[model samples]
Target: MSKLIWKALLASPAILGAAVVAASPASAQQVSSTTVPSVSALEATGDGSTLSNLDQLNQYGREGRARRANSAEQVTSVSQLSDVQPTDWAFQALQSLVERYGCIAGYPDGTYKGNRAMTRYEFAAGLNACLDRIQELLVTNVADYATKADLEVLKKLQDMFKTELAALRGRVDTLEGRISYLEKTQFSTTTKLTGEAIMMLAGATSANLDDLGDAFSGNNGDDNQVVFQNRVRLNFNTSFSGKDLLITRLQVGNSKGFNGVAGETVLTNQVFGDTGNQFTLDTLQYQFPIGEKGRGYLMANAGVWDDISNTLNPYFEDYDGGRGSLSTFSQRSPIYRLGGGAGIGVKYDFSDNWQLSAGYLAGEAANPRSGDGVGEGGLFDGQFSAMAQLTYTNDAKTFGLGLTYNYSYFGEGEFGFDNAGFVSGFTGTLAANVLPQQDAVTSNSVGLQGYYQFSPKVALTGFVGYTGVDSKGGSFDDADIWYYALGLALPDLGKEGNLGGIFVGAQPYLTNIDGDDVKTDIPLQVEVFYKYAVNDWISITPGVIWQVNPNQDNDNDDVVIGTLRTTFVF
Candidate 1:
């Protein structure tokens, strides 16, 4: 035993060798010939008298010599010791000590034997060798000699937050696995779902209806009664490539009672019924890139002018039932309604601030024969409007101006005087002055629209439009109409997502009549509204519209309309 201790002490080749020898008493004898036992064995044997500090140090000396003789390969990483794995509870500590302090060495075969029994003697010998190495590093002024101090701090920190760290790691692993599974099992990879719902309570009051010799006046006694309406939409937006989009919309509504056909009511809503209380495919549009500077949209089914135009009237063209203007005329220029049907449109951006847009839409493209098809009486020959607009946006992008022109060809029975084109204040119905089959007209319309943001929360918007109609072979007189409006809007009023607006304007009215003695009355319209957002997903709007002369006739009574609308989005 003395010789083995002397051998291990000399092999250390450091000051620790002298300390080791001095610490052990020469009188102490070997406890047993058996190999040094593990820590658990020492506790189990409980031979405290034989297990002296001097005896243990001498044993460490023997083991250190044996360990050095057998291990030739130096291992710096736990991975280099092939048997070590992260699942082992002590693996992290062993790795830190080996990597950070360069204190651990493996057998020539690269095995750590981490589970092998270890005695206090062997542990002491291992610690002594590590101390020698550290001293060598400090003497050489190596950069990593203070790793032991850092490790002490890290050890205390790890212990202080061990439970939280473990839980966080577990959650991260769970999330990663769940994301992987969802990627494989989720719905369409290219399609996403979106939806909107609207509810409205509305009523209108008017004193009398005018008689115009067979013209439809929508003179109903219940026109002033309050009624409830509902509309819901589900849209699927799909993308095959990154830059293109195809939209499919399914909608249903109970909005049949609000049309102007009832009591000369202004068209206040866009989500009215095609098939009341029944679900239907409302819109199908595809938007794709045309080039680096152009983009285009194709309407395969139910399309509207708002889908094709930038809608210079930026205040309220959302098309949702409960939002935007309470009256249709206040939404945009009536020319937009000239071709509110299926069509294709394109816009080319000359730069960030300038663009040119054009489109053609056929109002009655689903019927055939001499009146309403895509053929002689269809999209090409039936009632259709071709429109173009040039727009300029200011540097701040808060102001814009758009100049628009539209040319529409109307067939004998396809064009109606009740359309939005003539819904303004003074444009009285011309149906009584001409025979349906004998009268076909062509209209040329021009519109100027502009909006400026005076401040972050306030804006001013206005538009002026003119349309002139010429008769083909009918005996009716030609007419010209004019309409204009200026509005003030406050966005994010009271709170975010809220809006308030006031508008003063005139609906379309006849300005001139040729070859006839028909008298036309010019009417004025005033409106005020406020929209309050209850939360991120819901909003409510209340509004009122007053018309000085309803139906563009002097004999008719004034009209007042009131609406309370609520909207939900998801």
Candidate 2:
């Protein structure tokens, strides 16, 4: 009789799984609240010391019902399961349990779910349902299990695990009480709130007075003074369906870019901008799955291309948040910033390693009356950008590459490249973006981005792009814009959660304008910074930027910027 019970214990795993141990990560219906045991660890037990699986079984051993309703039904025969097949490797073991003790149950959907991951509580629920049937089987057919004397040995088995079973019951009771208290006090069951705050002390100046020609030798605005600035963001994330998400964000800031100065191109701090310290709605986006392999996005406001697609540069891109690079140009390709406000996008996964994405956004989409003017709305008639991209990433995601194409259009008047094409508030320098007044502009751009991780602690990322701009509805001739960047990242530089980085790139510059000699030299930027995570809620990043030919003119002086930034997240 002892041998029979020991054999059941030894063979429990065969009934527990072969496919269960091999289930894919995608099969998890919900994220585990606690760390899950590794597959190898679950496979073999050299000793009975590891009680995780045993605890799982006994968690509901005393209860007559399962945690889920459908899991409580009886499985008198193996044929009752639709997914189980005669060819399955575990078929014989499963049949033995079903025909002998009739102790088995399927998932709520009436499937055995052998390829899905479940928590300890879920496994316990299934095991408890089987235990209930075992009790019934023993009462109805004692002759099959043991004689009358063997029945007394069952009492000894129960006594042997008394303390262990009692401890398991105590844990389950504690968990239930904690869950009840949380439900009574939670802010919202469907929504979660998070926030980030940043403060910076910064200064910028020309590298030398002698290098600056008379064209920019004097009248450097108040950009020279060291100043303090800050920005704060509050995010509310809601989910009605477990697979979908709705995001709403609010922001306020008091920082104005040094671009207001004479020789600067892009802002040194990506998170700081000219907000006048007035709080405003920053983002509203809803995302949900479409069938199985597709996803759709609806951005009502402040939406950019990267929001709908993954930036190939994994460690470098931060979704324009406070954790990564300090400058806007270093965050991602300028093509992603061509036009942004309201937009829609769709993405499909061709395979685990390949993806296709397409999206459109209009910068001036809020206006009701259209015709190349601000405060006038037209979903397709005004300033807009459309893009398509195909990307590939290896299974480990250590190597990634992407190819993208973009078409952007902007009418004259209050629109047309944000600053007469001399510079872009999003990215690029004055020399690269030149559009004559009252002239509409249209551009076709192609770009490629890639990254490789050759070492455990180091990685390399590179991006290059070209944009051909044509003057529409006006007199200016066509032009060309070119840019490239290379980056080196040192993860966990000094400690965990810390990053040290170096980037060298030419923030978009003009190569040709109506065949006119636009610039004699490249407008290059080199940056280095280290972000030190002080804790879960705080970090300090100090960095400097050096720009050659600061104003896109080779004759002008180089510029240097220094900044120390602190961030808090919660």
Candidate 3:
């Protein structure tokens, strides 16, 4: 009876599994980034024929093959899923498949993500993978197999889907024609364009301007007015070899941003600009493989440590502000605020669980007058930051640790310390603003950052950073700065595409200088934010930031900032 059923199913245009899996293109479904080749490797070949349609299938097949090759661990029971419970309606079925049939598999992180929807192509690929596993199982146990009656039922189901499969086949045929046409007419075979736009409404409040006597006090008006700003970015990514990438980015924004309403640098989003909304070429970088386990990058234009460093601040590292923490200080350590210009960086993966990275960047690699430029006073002669870091993690990537060291040198008037020097930058404009004594300063900074995800929904992340700067060749004093933060993140909060975060930490505050202990009146930053994904291409985020002493002075009023930001991406 099973043999008869199998025969009936086999006679259908396509089996039930095939009908379920072969209706759409595999490219339409999301796949693991590690299991597929680069986009350049999968570019369309200019072949205008029925076979063009098969190219997409071939790509999916390659991904499937990659997955199979890497899937060496066979799960024997659903109990292995730490998050799944017996209360689930499908728990028994899933257990049966894993323990009895060995067809289902979970991620290395021990997640099933059972609620994730799959397209026909993805389904097909999964089915094929399971069938291959079953084949191996049957070879090992010839006596245990689907009964004759079960085969007959499968045959009947296949026949029932015969009409649907035929219609799908017709659609596939038409898709082949369309694919061929697109291949022949598509622009730039090696480049793609992607863009993002953000619109934000923000306002700030300060209450202590009436009692200050300093030269810089009361300069910021009492106008607690709301402001509107927009930022636009266009990214051009290209590849000649599949293993290399070239990036060119264009950006423009008109936000007063963090320029402090009254001569201060307050908390603001990374995307906020202080350039009065002038368009600029923001980034020019090329990343290419150095070896099987090594990679290197070169930045010919705008770049920063954020472009090259393995910033361990995971929950708050969104420079785009469309994701993660909203405050720039919350994003990562100020130690990584190295200025950009011509630079080189490299990384090596010693093993699957450990890696090392190093980089150098010059803030002024191109000023050809006399004291600066990429030549005389450039990468090696002028302002620069050199950094190295080591990181370790398990295969699941649920926990990670990173240790980093950076040495920075800044010439006179080149004090680009990512504002870690709160009052340092403003002193030159103060009552006795003496031009900073025209000295060269060197800073040694160290940072330790780590994160642990207890589960998919919750995680803890934090970092501690310290920098000691010494003035050399001038009459200036030495200063030590410290900053740290601990944050709790709840992802998929209230909905699948939402996130909630709260963190409290100190921004870069001067602890000591010239053998004198600096008094910190209010040195903490408190922040909270919620991001709701409106859709695949849009998100709405509402955030608040409270700075106890924005300038580390009791005379200054506590600062409160609120923002409603909307982001669009494509």
- Which ranges in model 1 have alpha carbons more than 4 Å from their true place? 1-187, 211-223, 257-264, 267-271, 368-376, 416-438, 514-517
Q: Give Cα-based local distance difference scores for all models.
A: 0.60, 0.64, 0.60
Candidate 1 vs candidate 3: the lDDT winner is 1
- Point to the candidate with the largest lDDT: 2
lDDT of 2 by residue, 331-426 (tens): 787766666678899999999999999998877677667687443457778778888999999999899999999888877633222321222345
Those runs of model 3 whose alpha carbons end farther than 4 Å from true positions after fitting are 1-187, 207-224, 258-278, 372-376, 419-437, 514-519
TM-score sort, best first? 2, 1, 3
Question: What is candidate 1's lDDT per residue for 159-261, written digit by digit as tens?
Answer: 3322222232333456668989999897657898988888888887744655432333233344457878778888999988978989999888776534232
In model 1, how large is the Cα lDDT of residue 338? 61
lDDT of candidate model 3 versus the reference: 0.60
For each candidate in turn, the TM-score is 0.65, 0.66, 0.63
Per-prediction count of colliding residue pairs? 11, 7, 5
Which has the greatest TM-score? 2
Error of 2 at 7 (Å): 39
The Cα error of candidate 3 at residue 442, in Å, is 0.9
For model 3 the local lDDT of residue 353 reads 86
